[model samples]
Target: MQALRDISGRAGTLLTAMVFVLLLTAFPATAADAGYKAKPEPSSGDFDARKVIVDHVLDSYYWHLFDIADRSYSIHLPVILIYEGRFYVFLSSRFDHGKADYKGFAVAKEGSRKGRAIRVLADGRTPDPDAATIYDFSITRNVLSIFIASGLLCLLFIKVGKSYRDADIYATPKGLPLFFEPLITFVRDQIAILAIGPEKYHRFMPYLLTAFFFIFFNNLLGLLPIFPGGSNVTGNISVTFVLAMFTFFTAHWYANKTYWKHMFNMPGVPLFLKFPIPILPVIEIAGAFIKPFTLMIRLFANMTAGHMVILSLTSLIFVLGSVSVFLGYSISPITVLFLVFINFLKILVSFLQAYIFTLFSAFFFGMAVPKDSH
Candidate 1:
C-alpha cells in the first residue's frame, strides 16, 4: 500500500508539472486578450537576476503565462481597492501588466514598496508611504493558487469521504482514496496518536490533517515554474501567521485544568517561589506565543530559502548568457544538472517541511493536554 501510494503521489505530481508546462505554451496564445504586448518593459536593467528571481516568487496581480520573442502574455486578475469610502473594482490589465497607472491606483514597480498595489494622488503620483489611502484586496497570484489548492482538497476529501461511507468491510478503496489512505493512517497513527495520546488524538485529527495537506500541497505547487503553480503561498508570512494562529488558539482552547495548573503553579516548584515574583508563570505564557511564532518562521524561512536557491541557480544561465554567448553555452550543461539536483532536493524538502510543521503542532497540542494525571 505504501509503495503504491508513493508511486501514485509521484505520478500526480509529475502530471501537475506537465500541465503547468502545457499551460505556459498553449494557454499563453489566448492570454493576448488580457493585454499581451510585443514588449512590455517594466525596468531598464538588461539582466537583473535578483529582480527576476524575486518577482517570480512574489505575489503579482497577473498570472504570467510566458514570454516568447519579446512578446509577453499574462492573465490579469481582479484588482479590488477601497479608498476614501468608495470601492473600486477592475481587472489588473488596466495597469498594463504593471506598466501604467489606472484611476488613481498603480502597481508599485520600484523602491521598498515594489510589487505592492499603491494609490496615486490627483496628479498621478504615489502618495507618501504613511499617507497612502489604498486598502488593496486584490486577488493576486498567491491568493488564486490558494483557492485552487483548497478546491482540490475539498474535491479529493469529499470523494474519499464518500468511499469510506459506502465501501464494505471486505471491499477495497479505489482511486484517490487508495493514494491518500496510507498518508491519512500515517498521520493518525504516527503523528496524532503518538503525539497527543490515543484518547485525545481523535478530537484533533481534523485540524492536523487539514494543516498537513495544505502546507504539503502549497509547497509542491510553489516549486512549479509556471502560472497557477509558481506562487509561493506557503512562503508568504501572512499565510503562515494565520496557520500559526490556528494552532495557538487550538492549543489553549482545548487545554484542560491540569494544563492551566502547570502553567500557573508548576509541579515540584516551591510555593514561595510562585509568590512575590510570578516570573515562572510569565515565562510559561510567553513560551506559548513563542512556540507558534517559531512555527510561522520555520515554515516561511524553509520554503522561501529553497525557492531562492533554486531560482538563483537557474538564473545563472541567463546571467551568463547576457554576458557572452560562449560563456552561456559553456555553463548550460552544469547549470541544468545542478538545477535538476536542486529540484529533487526541493521535492524532498516540501514533504519534510509539511511533516515537521504538523509534527510540532501536534507536539504542542500534546503538551497542552496530557492524558495521565500527575
Candidate 2:
C-alpha cells in the first residue's frame, strides 16, 4: 500500500517537471513569432501569406523576437564561413536582416543560395561566381534550439540519476525519479525486453531511452506557440536523418554473423532464386536501407505537417481580412475553435509518434540479434 502511494506521488512530480520543461523550452521560439500580431495594415501593405508561412517553417540565421510600429526586432546568431581558404566570422546582424553586405558576404535573397550567406561581387548585389564554393558553418536558429534542448535533457537526467543514487532501495521514490521510474521501466520491460529479448535488451537501453525521451520532449515543445518551443527540431529532415542513421548503424554494427548471412541468403528460399538472379538477397539488402529511410521520413513529415496546418489556419484570418473585415471577423472564432481542437489532437500525436519511433527502433534492434541468443 505504501509503495503504491509512493509511486503515485512520484508520477505526479514527474508530470509537473515535464510541464515546466516544456514551457521553459517554448519561450524562445514563441518570442520570435510574437511580432506576427504587429504585421502591417491590410489597407496599405501587401501580405504574402506563403512567404510568412515559409519563413516561420524554415530555419533562419537570426531569431526574430517581435515587431513594434513596423520596426523589426531579432537576435542575430554567429555566422562562420570559409571562403577561398580564408575563415570569416561575424554576427548575422552585420547583414542588416538581409539588406546590406558585410566583409564581402551577404545573405542571398534568390538563386540556389536563398536564405544562406553568399559572397557578393564588388557591386554588392550580384553573387560572385568564383565564391560559389564557400562553406558555411553558421549557428542557425534550429541548431541553437537543438543545443538548448540537449542541455536541458542532460540536466534533467542528471538530477534524476542523483535522486536514485541517494535513495534507499526500499524507500518510496520521490521527485524526478518517481515520475521517470515508471516510464523508464515501461521502455525497459515493454519495449526493450519484448522486442530485443531480456538477455540482449540491457545493452541497448541507453540508446532506446535517449531516443524515446528526446523525440517525446521535442515533439511536445514544438507544439508550443512560444519561443524555444517553435523551432521544429524533430521536424527538420537533417535531425531525423541523423537519428535514423544512429539506429541503422547500431543494429548493423553489433549484428551477429547469422544476421548478415540471412541478409544475403535466406534459409527457405528456392535454390534457383539464389543462384540465377539472386532476387531474394537483393530485396533483403534493400530492406535494410528502406527501414531507416522510413523512420526518417515518418518523423519529419508528421511534425512538419502539423506545424504547417496550424500556421495555415492562422493565416486564413489575414487572408480574409484582406478581402473583407466582416469575413475575417466571422472566421476568427471558427478558426480559433479549430486551432484549439487541433492543438489538443497534436498533444496526443506527439506522444504517439515518439512511441512509434522508439518501438520500431527496438524491433529492428531485436531483428538484428540471433534467435540462439534469445
Candidate 3:
C-alpha cells in the first residue's frame, strides 16, 4: 500500500502518456448505427461476454479507435500496437474477431480501414502479426487497471515521503499534496482507530490509511459512467485474491508466539486428541486462511454484483422499455433516478466492505498473535 502511493507521485510525462494509451484502450468501439433498440442485439453478431466486459472496462482506452454511438453497442476498448506489419483489433477475444489465431492476433493493411483512427501507429496495420506480436497485452481490462492504479499509488507515496523529509512538516501542505492530509486523518481516526482499536492500531495506521484511500478512490471512480476508472477494477477476482493474500500475510506477520501455540501446539489437550484427533489445531489453521479468503470474495463479489445489477436494470429501456418519445420520458427518468439512489447505497457499501475486510483482517491478526504478547 505504501509502495502504491510512491509510484503515483512519480508518474512522469512518459508514464502519464503510457497511461493515456492504456486507459484509452478501454473505450468501447462505435458500432455502425447510433440508434437505440428495444432489445439488445445478440453479441454473437461479433460480440460475446469477453468482449462486452472488456469494452465496458476499456471504453475510454479504446475510445478513438471505435465509438459507442456509432457502433451498435460495443463496450470493450479496441487495441492497436505495432506488431510485425499488419494491424490487429485488440480485445477481440482470441481467434474470434478476424484475429490471426488462438494466439490472439491478426494482420491487415496499415492505416484506418474505414473510419477507424490509427492513433500513434505509423500505419494502420502491421505486415507481420508475429514479429513484435502479443496477445491483448497478455492482460485483462481489470488487471491492467489494477497495475495502473497500483503504480499511481506508489507515485503518491513517494512524493509524500520526500515532502515529509524535505519540506517542513510544520508548514501547510502545498499544492496537490494538501488534499491528502484530511483523508489520512479520517482513515486514522474514523477507520483505523475505530476498527483496530486505538491501543494497537497506531502501528497499522500506514496500512489502514492506504487501504482506505485506495478503495475509496477506486470505488468512487467505478461509479463514473466513462473512463478506465469505472471498469470494476476493485471487483476483479484476481485483484481481490491479491488483497486477500495481503490480509492473510499481514495476519500471519503480526501473529505472536501465543497465537501460534493456540493454533498448533495448544495447551491442555488430551494426549490421545493431540496425536490422532487434532481437531482444534486443524480448525484453527484452516480458519486463519479461510477468514481472509472470505473477506476478499465477499468484497469483490458484492461490489461487482451491485454494479452489474444496476447497469442491467437501468438499461432495460434500450433492451425492452422501447424507444417511443413518451416511453423514454415516462420511464427512463425514474429508472435513472433509482439508479442514482442505488448508487448512493453502493457508496455506503464500498466503505462498509473495505472496513469489514480490514477489521476482520485485524481481528484475525490479533487472534493469531499470542494473546499475551501485549
Give Cα distance to truth, residue 372, candidate 2, Å: 4.0
Off by over 4 Å in 3: 1-69, 72-137, 172-178, 190-203, 268-273, 323-326, 371-374
Better of 1 and 3 by TM-score: 1
Q: Which candidate is the best by lDDT?
A: 2
Model 3 error, position 240 (Å): 0.8
Q: Write the per-residue lDDT of candidate 1 for residues 1-374, one digit (tens) a residue.
A: 98798678767765775466434423212212212221233343255667666776677898888776666767899998888778989999998876688887788878766787787666555654555467878898888999998998898899899888888846555566766877899889989998999889988899999999999888877776665576788998889999999999999999988889889988788877678898789899899999999999999999999878876766676568667868867887786677666777777788898888899999999999986457
| Best model per TM-score | 2
lDDT for predicted candidate 3 compared with the true structure: 0.55
Per-residue lDDT of 73-165 in model 3, one digit per residue for the tens? Answer: 333444554444655555643323333332333433233221122222333234333344332333444545566667777888788768877
How much lDDT does each candidate structure score?
A: 0.78, 0.80, 0.55
lDDT of 2 at 192: 93
Candidate 2 lDDT over residue span 1-374, tens digit each: 98797667766677787667544533323323523732634456455677676677777788776676767777899999998788899999999888889989998887766788988988788888876588988899888888878888899999999877787978766766767788899889989999999889988899999998898878877777755667778888888999999999999987887788888877776888777889888988999999989999999999888877777777777677677879878997787777766766677778788888888999999989878522
> Candidate 1, residue 205: CA error in Å?
0.4
